[model samples]
Target: MAGISKSFFKAEPGQLVESDGELFKITHLMSISSVLAVNIKTNESVRLHVENLVPISPTEVTEKKYEERLHPDLALFSDDEWAEAQRRFQAIKPLLQNPIRTREDAETIATKHKIHPATLYKWLKLYQDAGHVSSLVPTKRGRKTGTKLLASEQEKIIESAIEDIYLSKQRHKPQDVIEEVLRRSRLAKIPPPHPNTVRNRLAVLSPANTLRRRGFKEAARNKYAPILGQFPGADYPFSVVQIDHTEADIILVDEAHRKPIGRPWLTLAIDVYSRMIAGIYITFEKPSATSVGMCLAQAICPKREYLAEVEVGGEWSVWGVMGTVHTDNAKEFRGTVLERACEEYFIDLQWRPVMLPHFGGHVERLMGTMANEIRKLPGTTFSNPTQRKGYDSEGMSALTIKEFERHIVEFIVNVYHQRVHSQIGMSPKQKWELGVLGDANSSGTGVMPIPADPLRIRLDFMPFFERSVQQYGIQIDGISYYDKVLDPYINAADPDNPKAKRSFLIRRDPRDISKVYFLDPVDQRYVPLPYRNIGYPAMSAWELREVQQTLKTQGMRNVDEHMIFEALDRMRVRIEEAKQKTKAARRQQTRIPLPKLPVVVFSKIHSPADKSMNQNERNFGMAEDDPFAQPIKPFDEISIIR
Candidate 1:
């Protein structure tokens, strides 16, 4: 086994790479997406996709230590040797930024610089392979030529000046460093090194080391640290996805009143391999299982109908249950509800390694990018108080949650997905398509399998309660739901306990209790059960609680379903009346809290083996008693706009 630096994926010519248990020498980098390599033993040439290459770990290599070779001491070269190296660096510098694609291109550059094309290619190979100027220093055959033989005192003086003056918190200028070295040399009664020598030494100091010594350790790590090799397992699209939450840096207005409400939290999922936005969940609600469920559900399902509803003219093709859902160790991600649901769906749920934030680098970086985009909006809070100082974020609030969501989707589909990603050297959508469909150089894994029962998958992630069905239907948190679908289990007794009622599985989307789901015991399929009375206005669990508390304050003791609906109507009227008079009312009424969960009342059933449920035909229709201002759209056209 041999270890390879992750940078080898860039596939510079002259670099050795291993694929499929044989070694190949990269001859040319054709483009970001393609490479040309020749077998070392057989001399047979083959093309490859950059993505098909694996990062070679240094620990596995026994023949050579690549790290030591890549980083050599600049002091080893004499003045003339360093100058020749500098000349070679200057000749190839332009090509580093605008790389030559073929031998003809290299020949053109060689002719312009008056160097033979073969010599230019050799210089390019060494520089690109090591990514340093020192790699260009000509190797000496015998005793090193032009080697600087300085006395111990003079050498110590130069070293001290570089470390203490040039690379200190004060960040002294290069001229200041030269002067310090000269002054020290004068005091010690020693000959001083040339100014060019001092400058060359400064240039050879590792950029990361220089930055760290100058008080920019974090920036150094961000710019220079090895990232791809550190976190593994994201081998292809949908192999590993990172999901996380952050408060959006923009104020939002209420849909109805159009007044400043507050900032909303955004839960985002990004596929690490492609850096594509797998799914997004934005709401006024705090981060909870509800948010995670909605985000994951969106990630695993198609988005054609959703795009139509949002009126965004673009395709968001990334979907399907990911191989693993990676998230931080937050309590919301660790809840039993989420764990159980992922387990049932065969999705691997992994937590970030304890105390290691870099494990979540993908999602965190995506959040930063989204934040940067959001800060440009009119009502942006701008990330911090200093950035927001003198700015009127609340007063400038214009977009409602729905409007903001539309903007985010448009940005993701049109702008972000189309831009070239620095690390992958291609757009996210391009990477995603390549991973799915493949190309001439490699084979794709194919698109992931779409979940057959979207609604059941959603329900599994939502909060659940085990309650025994009764004649009046199911009651949850004092709200009752009824339908003929639950008749089999009505007053059903537990087989294990003859004296006690059998508890059945019931789940609800807290945002809307107008309907709840019943996991029928006999058939193992979920049944949608609307409210027992059916006339209640669709309201969130928060609003329901507010109504319940208001009734209690007004001296009403036993609240019924009818009383709740009647109170809701009055509350809406009061909200409308007060909205114009006070900002608090407008804020309270900011969001209607439309069901964030999918409209899957008519969706198909879960068919995992041994999953028992009653054999009754699933009644896939809005309850006859339920009232609606408009007809509920057929399930096929249903879309979760958020």
Candidate 2:
């Protein structure tokens, strides 16, 4: 006992210890008092002398013991019998530590521990041979084979049934698959598997594999395939720009009449590196090559007084030639004009692979965020009709185009740009500055400058048409344009063939039909050509088409310039009537207006016909007129009636 005690170490708190042939867990160690506070097997608390305590190993305390001496078959033993066996083994543990050379020696040690000599010798031999306490634990006493249904032939049948019947588009049940397996097994003269066994086997199949087997390739890919890699980000501002177009969820009214015009399409460009919006264009026109061109033009050109015009107070400052433009495979993005425009500016154009939306996720996400903001506005259609159910979007729409544009500008500058972006961990404005300057307080001397020849770039992106200069003027889509700039090219012969009439490349802004740009081949300069009927009001391509359709509906022939203008006038009257009738328009009239800078009006030399026309004709003649223009009221003296 003394020898054993000398070899044994002090037991710590929470250690399993043996005292008086009973297992006790040391709850606390009172080193000062040389006593251990212990919980007995029955969970009774008691204090014991530290000298009497011997630490028991976790394996000895927890592991079940068996009756079999060598590789004991523990399966036959009940829980009480196993526990008794473990106690017996623990009793003989101290004696086994000393070597027993003979049967007499084993008998002496067994007598001291109160165990049979034969049993003692057997346990000693077993412990010596295995050299591990776990080896003393007996396994279950039976053939350790798993279910007989897992045989190769049975497994093959089960797998075949699962593939053919269970994992299918029809979504066959597990019981049906089991039945199919049983039927197949019966035909082959093999014993049928239990239904539960078949179900367990089928349950092991992965969800992705099941989906794939059911002909859901996309679902399988989404569930099991690795996520798409992050976009190879740009190092500097404008190194990569992503552009996309989305229809705004909110309905907007015309600036003049304040009647619901419908949802406007917005083309937006975002700088990939800084996550800053480079430019945006909002219009009622559908997304086309012309829209893309207009967006790109705005993106590259330096923003002048646009912020002021929109009543926004921050410096937008984002502008420059993009090194690379990334976009999805939209018709507008794939147009030759867009390609040529990019090529002219040495910009690399990349189209994302089909169905891989993650490539252009930055711009797409920006558009989504913008749409969510728009959904909070007064007249949002809420992305889809399901979400817009019970909401009167058209009736609630109270924002004019100019007002909406201002709100968007304000949101971009004051809200979106200033908010800390989750991905970048900084505001877009800060990121833009960091990307441009590399350090806080540093000037943006390294920023890429805007193109020197902005007009040339603009002309390259504008929608163009090939027309010959006739004796009267160049007729474009039923409208004739004339300018002194076209005089040099008038009746000009083709350089290649003298007899053939020369065709000139004419560029026009869809937003304004009052003027067109004629590319002069001789000097390579664009010549601005005004409409032949200068009095004809500037109209968008969409408005012009609408008026043309209206005329066609009315069965009106001779769709001349005068008739077109008259149709526009009639449409204006209808729009005004709609404004007066609409509850939304009346609500808009009551909202307090924001303070704006005085609009700068540029003097224009009116044509003879424009001078002779009324004030309404002059108001809508140019596309550049103040969008927030108000009708002038005639002055009258105040009368005091008695």
Candidate 3:
């Protein structure tokens, strides 16, 4: 009684209690002022004030029972309690048989159940509303089921804090999130939940989802985004080919002086199905449309003559018209000439999506493999500075450009084509043959044959320029070109725009600037236009620029064609001197084999004077069959006088 309250006594019905050291069992809790009980030893009823009563044993009320007593409005009782309530209803059913219940009947039922008079009517109303005995049971205590702080204003404050402060680029931690949640809750005049509860909620989110919400879209896409697999249609050889460009890791020396030149760029094409190296173009120039064109042309043409030129021991027969060509979003791959060439060959060109490297993985992997092999060579830069820190790549350089090209050709034909690839489980050459032959155990795909006219493909991939035909000839790159076949188109007005000059399509081979191919609109045939200076040496655009630079460095004023050629001859002599003096040049000259001169179709055409000239004099201004030949004098200086 000293510790208990009056309300506590009222809730202790059917509980054992002690009064004046006598144990008693509480029969009923009449009111907060009085409680009725029977003595356990004497079995006599006694009425006592709640202040004089003390509980001997507290009632063992379960969660369900306590909940029922706290909220008696809803149905949330146990099975035994509901059955007892149903029995009480059945007993009162006879009293209200006529369906006309009165106060007397309600009072009688309340007395029979030992409950309050108003509680009986409440039960009857609940029974009528639910039409079931379960409705008579009392509702559970505390907040109702599905009702908590989650639906309260405090939860809204926490969620707003999470969205505004936590899910930001700053990437706040969970403790920071909790602090912000508390601050917002206090600002909104609401109590915040525990920190652990908020942490539990945040734990449900995935790391990717969190990064996507907090970090920028591009970062999230690069780090967490899913990668797409190979294109679905790339199941057969020549079905899909991937093309890409990479700078070789090895530094090369010039053929003439053997001076250390910068690394060369390589444009490579790989067949997706067989994992075969289809085409490759290596040059000291930067990657451009010319490189793409050259690589694709080499891939489409027969490689028998090329193999002989490179002196490869093994057979490299892989060549054909690819069904689809896949490449990156580089400007070189998207050139107008490349698109036109692909269209002419009935090939589909597909550009991979931006920022996705997996689309061109095959070619990229091949480049990596080749770069690894190059690292083993003497003049290799070794990919990065870490691997090349102590090595003197420039000083140890021994291979010239021509020798390196031969080495690459040999590696591709003899080594890479014969080794077993990890993905294909067989050599690239073997897989290619199997795919072409349609072997039952292979991919079972037939290969398309190479085009009938190989020279047409070579002409198609050449870089072109728009020029106007004049009486003198079409001037290109500060050089005048003339041919008798352009007689009809010379001085013609443009049919599309009369005010504008008539433009004709002209294709040039950068490797040889002696002539240009003029596309005749009337007959749709290419005509060769030779340079005005027929005595000029057959040199590349690179060589011409080098010659110009050499003359400028020599303090030559008002440089002309004669001055450029004179400086070029002098530079040739200096290169020969260096070749004999430099250690790199001496080593290269001894170890590397001499390469044959590349043949061009335009070289077949000969002038009248060329036929009369002896073989020694004809070496210059004719095909470069002799590498050590001297430059010929001007055509006017050489007169037969016969």
Candidate 4:
């Protein structure tokens, strides 16, 4: 399945494909990120994800190295086999549509086709996933259940040898395991199995299990995980989730100062199946791997705790591991950190095709809808300068970051999810329910699996780097992190090269760099490493960066860990001073501050007189009305049931 890689998922309208052995022609792309294909044999139309359709011509598939993508030859099917495939396709076609059918619908169709309702639905799923009519072909039954060519006693001997010799802390070689098995068989006076048969048994053992058992836990986590090649279509809930970033179209204010900071960047993920918002992360920081990771972690885990944290009342039910995360080929999205994290969770990460923006239509549409909602807020820039004409965007800026987050969550869970979508002919929440829980007309595919360890999932996606532990512990970006657990790996050398140090994986949340997680070699658990000198307060990576920049500007030739923390402390003092001055001035101003209708003011002081103005007066000059300073109550709290 060489060409059956991402190239095979390339689809266009009017292309011929085989589904359930029957031929079908792709009609057009659907709004829900799906494609419409009409069955050639029965003239029945069906909606399918592009992955569902297999290439009809043998020439379409090239040789591939991977074993997963199988390009079955449809030309070999006999006339009778093709007719039976057509019959199965027709029987299951109605169940493929949106607003999934009920048990009643399944029973009625099952009776007409002379098939069991359960069997009919199973066939529907097989065809849906493979997109080949061959999926419906009858299996040539031969072997009875639990039947094995070898005697049970011989099988037990082989299993024991594999467990003891192949899967051991000492890491025995394959040849060693086979020799041991043969020796044992001979001692029992039984015929020995072929070397390949023993090798085949070893191969059946899961790669992760084998690696972990052989004391290569790090390798098991990093190297042996599967990377899915094909992008499953947006045919089901969590099938394909798209994420993108945009600078929010409004100015936000600082909590204490009550003055505009700047527009924040919004990282949003939307499930293509039901047009539901899967996850969102908003920050003043530019788009980076951390933002992508945070957004994805939110999407994959439950949102109940998150909703409560944000103080939003409505339910956000769209959470799970998506089949494919479709994103643009930005540098952040292409990073190894994201790629490996997705792989560890069995997620297929697909990039949008070059020069095709339409491939990311769902997230783009959601962004637009969000922008429209943002326009109604107090400090909206309204998407353009023309729209903001005579409007006091900065002067009207009143909402703090927390307040703005509340509004966004309110809009997503309360307004957008509940509103009737024109394209889907139902609210996103309604469609999501139908897909997850099924309706009167169709059987529902249950919800996607929730992560067992939610915190671990979040930590897995955070920024990570590899560093060898030393006597002083690990130093990263001018911070020293240490814990007693690192003592075993201190100054550890690589097994392959004695002179080289072994680099251990360390992950840290950018939001708080006070500690870093060290991947312990002993138990393969993430050990928390706090600052060696814990007196320094916790600070963000962004704050550390700014302090480094300030030090360089002041002509500091050699900066160290202590210098960075000292600079951060000074910066924190400056922020506290600004907050105090703003609060004091508010007590004096009886009249509401006047609104300023402009973006941002960056100017040079022409004279010494201008420069001599106190910092308070300079900052307070840009302040707006007290009413604008108050927290915004944009919408009423709306609670939703699951």
lDDT ranking, best first: 1, 4, 2, 3
- Summarize candidate 1's per-residue lDDT along 1-642 as a digit string, tens digits: 111111112345665666787677778766444568988679999996553444343443455443322332233245567667767877876676574367777778899999998888789898765544667888857645444456668778878999889889999999998999999999988899889878867876768889999999989977865343244478788888889999999998877777887889999999999999988888787798889988998787656556665667777877666768888878888876786556434467877766888888989999999999999898999988998999999889899888999899999999999999988999999998888767899876654544333454466567888888889998987778888877877888876455679888777777767877776655455667877876666787778888899999999988877787789889878988988776667766743444323323343444443134233223123333111112334343221212
- Greater TM-score among 2 and 4 belongs to 4
Q: For each candidate in the order shown, give its overall lDDT on alpha carbons.
A: 0.72, 0.67, 0.66, 0.71
Residue 384, candidate 4: C-alpha displacement in angstroms: 1.7
Per-residue lDDT of candidate 2, residues 1-642 (tens digit) = 000000113345676667788778867644312345556658887887554555566776557431112222112233334434454555456666454466676677788878788877677565444432333343446532132325668888988999889888888988889889999999988887778889877765667778887889899977754333333458778888999999899887755556676777899999988888988887666788877887787787555446755656766767767877888878888875676556435467777777989888899999999998999899899977899899999889988767788888889888999999999999998888777656655543243443333455566677778888986789887788887667777788965456779788777776666677766665445667777977676676666787899999999987887788788778766655656677443433322122222332334544455456555333332122222223232222211111
Q: Which stretches in model 3 have alpha-carbon errors above 4 Å?
A: 1-232, 441-447, 495-501, 542-642
Judge candidate 3 against the unseen true structure and give its global Cα lDDT, from 0 to 1.
Answer: 0.66
Cα-based TM-score, every candidate: 0.57, 0.53, 0.52, 0.56
Which pairs of residues collide in candidate 3?
none
Q: Model 4: residues >4 Å from true position, as ranges? A: 1-231, 553-558, 575-642
Residue 412 accuracy (lDDT) in model 3: 91
Superposed model 2: Cα runs more than 4 Å off: 1-232, 256-259, 383-391, 440-445, 453-455, 547-642
User: In angstroms, how far off is 217's CA in candidate 4?
Assistant: 36
Residue 134, candidate 3: Cα error in Å is: 84
Worst 10 residues of 2 by lDDT: 1-10
Return whichever of 1 and 4 wins on TM-score.
Answer: 1
Q: Superposing every Cα of model 3 onto the true structure, what RMSD results?
A: 38.7
Which lDDT tens digits does candidate 4 get at residues 499-526?
7798887878777677777766554456
